[model samples]
Target: MYSVVFQEICSRYGKTYSWDLKSLVMGKKALEAAQIVIDVLQLPMSKEELVEESQRKLQELFPTAELMPENSPEQEWGDFWAERTGCAVPENEGLELLPEAALGTRDVFKPAAFTLPDDAGRVYSSLPAPLSRSPPHAVQCLVFEDAPNGVEAALTAGMQVVMVPDENLSRDLTTKATVVLSSLQDLQPELFGLPAYE
Candidate 1:
């Protein structure tokens, strides 16, 4: 989805979007990514202009894209986690899922009460009573992430992270993850001391 939009943006300026450029921006916030692109490409546009164009292209392209394999429509994510953990994970309680609109592309660039590593701590703090009455130490948390930044955030918060990284990402970038898998389908819960899938 992002690559298509990026390609369109690059083509407009007669610049080809390369894998190297994609890697640099892969896990960055939208504004940060846009700035990087402009600086790297020496594009004749402001970061805001690039971001707006990319967002416009994304909005058009996203509707036609298929859901990621992990986001199967038949299984609600909260329920999936609840079943796997044998614990209640009601939305916004044991688990909080925010839509893209809630965290706007621009919102992440600014300092916030909750961000990245701190957000990981907040999530642990906000776990429902059934999940943890007292704040469970961050060491008790297991995070599943797809980006190097997210893995770093989980580790910074003292949690282990299972990373399912993009195939194009460098192996060196994946070294910090507790475990790395090519896809979510390859995950083995029992390996992490979680119950095996029934």
Candidate 2:
């Protein structure tokens, strides 16, 4: 659907997106991507205007659009991005922490193994009870989520969240995130007091 829309935009502007340029735009923030499209295609529109028009077009097309096909490309990209960042990519699935090999090298090891919202709340409540001086407080931990439910759970636990929602997610829903990003690649660890990439 996005490809179709992008093609239409290109057709209208008499331009084409190369694979390399598309890759650059893939993980950029919405406005950033809009600016790239407008600039690269030399479209006769401001970034804000392009964003508004794109949103309007998307709104009209989304209801009738088919679901995107499932693929491993995005998963591969995520793995590559995480490795490049030197960050452990722990899979925080239901009540489980599927830490990768690199996780063992870390000095601290506290997995956020929560299956449900109630479980998350319990974890948050217990943090200050046993160790008030140490870290892992709700405010100190930042949640990076792609799902709306996960965002809600983290917010409910009083933790700040940086949500990298799928493109199809409603704009209204994205506001629930403390910060919304296009991808993990766009994350600034320094903003959360984590070590920045050199």
Candidate 3:
């Protein structure tokens, strides 16, 4: 019974190992079934020191081959889905209930009070940054004007900050954080060795 069950498992998964099947499923009955196949098939080692040792012996006895590469991400998410949308599935913010409700709220407080330095202003990028695969640490500091990001400082130190200009600047400016990329194209994988899709 165990040997027959093992044969069925092997037929379905296209793998040639009791240990792999054992890892996928758990139980003594499954182990017993694998043993039966090992015993009847005269597998090289039913009791090797390690599974790799067992695999080596099995290869010698059976001349192992595979119909497909095991770790192909291509096999996981077909070509179209993999190539489509660069695989950055936009997260649903789940703000449907109060989507625009927060806009006119009284609780969303602005800075209570603040003053800008008379001599303070923002620095300008005379040219755009080119694409590079440098690691994030390569940049001692990053700057952006008003795109959604983290760790921003208000422009108040006499052009000591980097500015990213966009047409969609709101009347009430969030002049705190610095934007990294001037456009979405700047976020390409070729710039980071993580090119979207494959």
Candidate 4:
């Protein structure tokens, strides 16, 4: 969705959106991402203008958006927890912790703070008290991430992260992850001291 909107924006300036640029902006905050795009492409518009135009286009496209096939398990996991807890678990449980919320700003993009390198460790450090009666230390936590930024964030928090990167992502960007796999299906929980899948 972002690529689609970015392509449209870049096309107006006769610039093509490349995956390299996408990688840089992928996990950043909206304004931050917009600034990177503008600076890198040397676009004529300001960050705010780029963001506004992108948002307008996104609103029109989002209605027909479909969930990625790989994300189906996330929904299943939410449903499983909701069933056991007898409380509604939203599919996007961490939405409230997005940078937009933290910065008191609103945007169509919803990158969670946990995906931001500087904020990830801080947010993870604070999760224990509210979420558990006996919270484990940061080192005891295992994170599952699909982006390099997320892997960096979890590592900064002193947690091991299993990265399931997009196939097109550069190999050099994946070296920092404690573990890397092509898909979640390829992950063996037992390897990380967690229970084996049934």
Q: What TM-score would each prediction reach against the true structure?
A: 0.67, 0.38, 0.18, 0.68
Each prediction's Cα lDDT score? Answer: 0.60, 0.55, 0.31, 0.61
Predicted candidate 4 versus true structure: per-residue lDDT over 1-198, tens digit per residue: 779989998998999888878877765656778898999999999999998888777767665655435348754543343343222111112233323322233222223333212344422222211222123443466666666765665676677888888887888988999888887666776887765554
Give the lDDT ranking, best first. 4, 1, 2, 3
> Residue 13's C-alpha lDDT in candidate 4?
92
For candidate 2, write residues 2-113 as lDDT tens digits.
5566667677878775544454454344577778888777888888887676666666665563322334554444445456443222232212221233244332434444
| Candidate that would win on TM-score | 4
lDDT of 3 by residue, 70-98 (tens): 34642333333334322211111111223
* Cα lDDT for residue 5, candidate 1: 78
As for candidate 3, its clashing pairs are 120-158, 121-158, 121-159, 144-178, 144-179, 145-179
Looking at model 3, which ten-residue stretch has the lowest summed lDDT?
Answer: 88-97
Once superposed on the true structure, which residue ranges of model 1 sit more than 4 Å away at CA? 68-80, 86-139
Candidate 2 weakest ten by summed lDDT: 124-133
Model 4 error, position 164 (Å) = 1.2
The true-versus-predicted C-alpha distance at residue 139 of model 4, in Å, is 4.3
Give the C-alpha lDDT of model 1: 0.60
Lowest summed lDDT across 10 adjacent residues in model 1 is found at: 88-97
141 Cα displacement, candidate 3 (Å): 19
